[model samples]
Target: MISVQGLTKTYGGFRAVDDVSFVAAPGRVTGFLGPNGAGKSTTMRMMTGLTVPTSGRATIGGHAYRDIPNPGRHVGVLLDASAQHAGRTGREVLALGAGVLDLPRSRVDEMLETVSLTRQEARRRVKDYSLGMRQRLGIAHALLGDPEVLVLDEPANGLDPAGIHWMRTLLTDYARRGGTVLLSSHLLHEVEVIADDLVVIGQGRIVAQGTKTELLQSTGTVVRAVDDAALERALAEAGISSVASPDGARRTEAEARQVGEAAAHHGVVLLELRAADGAGLEELFLTLTSQTQREGAAA
Candidate 1:
């Protein structure tokens, strides 16, 4: 299992990560999420020992990352696919990782095949590879050790829809076989589709963490009217509290039925209304992190 307790990182006077604590359990995929500058990446960096933590601890199977013997065999990390040596062939990249971890060279071929990299493509220099191909190569390098835990940051960033689906399947299969996975992504739709658990951070602190089902159940509904003020007034009259979304949509804990009835009673015209689940991952993400969002004036 992957564990982080009271993890914090500071730069100058800025607190990049603050008291972050969560666990990515064995046999489960934990989706780590946040908007830009929410500190999700900082926390992941700390967990992998890429950056020093100002305080607290991060561990894999009860041992600090630096203390683990043959650390690559214990945890696989893919923080940046593009960080690979552009001069090296995809095969060479994985071969080097295998060598570092003291794995047989056969493991490189195995991983290349596992990530769907054909022999011809693996022989090409990484500088010629597309972002998608680089991602595949990076994934192969991470898995070269056949580690029990995976920490990937935006692994699907450059993948097409089909590639993303393939990645989801691969990680899910890994977890099914008892591997731990912590996946960080801005793509909430993909995360929602595959994550067993979720950890949401904003402004250097964890805002929410729980099983996917639990988080979705707590997400409320969003409703919007041609006249937003009218909708708000109607909801107010019905004793339902709501806050306007950035786009003028209003979100509330009230169910759709209740909101509709209130609109009818107040003679208001609703432009849109949907449960949080029906609205999909975007609505839930916006609602949860709305307070921390950094908005700019109209262009």
Candidate 2:
């Protein structure tokens, strides 16, 4: 439902986003992730038309955001989730939001309750609301028009554990019902739980884009066994390469779960079977980006 092509944004000499391209499919939540100052937010802003790109193009359903009628109704956006009128009550703010979207007043209350902002709190000024409350309020505002596509930046930032779970569940449900969700987050575990697809950025460029399973599969894993010598011999016969630990420790992250099962069937003693850090999506992200940065610096 969303496509970004060669979307590049530059701030003088620094490129915030560079030649990034990806697609957010309907009926799925796509994780937009990157390290600190990797231009994740900049990319989101450009996609939502809050900030124009220096070059290249992004579109929703084949049209530029500005060309969409009632873009708010076509896309729900919660950029900060904390920016709100300090003096306005949650209800008033959402009500005003409804007006802007030409939605009914009931939508205001519906979304307020949807985000679990109690009637009492809804009546209180936004200035009195906690960070989480403000975030929910921002979410309520975003949902006021019941848009089909959602672009969220750190939606779970300040939410409590339960709140974060709720947010994840809600996003999942939305996608299940055919909503397109493009969420940018720094929380890898959180994204791992919710995202079916991922688009990773580093130094303003997209380094990886695919389903979670696809990205995870891209980097092979090692599984370690307690009987290092025996396991290494077995793996060598099986055509798998493994290194011996300095202490004669035998370990492998060679695809974890399934490999463990296979090894067990082969009578490989179970010592420790878990994913090695260097072979997962997280490791791939760090290794790829850091290498790129080092190369850029050396040049």
Most accurate candidate by lDDT:
1
Taking the tens digit of each residue's C-alpha lDDT, what string does model 2 give over 1-299?
99999999988998889899999999999999877788899988998888989999999978888889988888998998668999999999988888888888888878977999899999999899988998898888777787889999998888899999889888999999999999988677888889999998888888778888877753444455677666766766665545444444434435676566667767987666655543455554554455344433112
Candidate 1, lDDT over the whole model: 0.88
Would you estimate the TM-scores of all the predictions?
A: 0.85, 0.78
lDDT of 1 by residue, 79-152 (tens): 99899999999999888888899999999889998999999999999999999999999888888898999999
Error of 1 at 29 (Å): 0.6
Give all candidate RMSDs, comma-separated.
Answer: 4.5, 8.1
Which residues of candidate 1, in runs, are more than 4 Å off?
A: 218-249, 253-279, 295-299
Q: Where does model 2 exceed 4 Å of error?
A: 218-281, 291-299
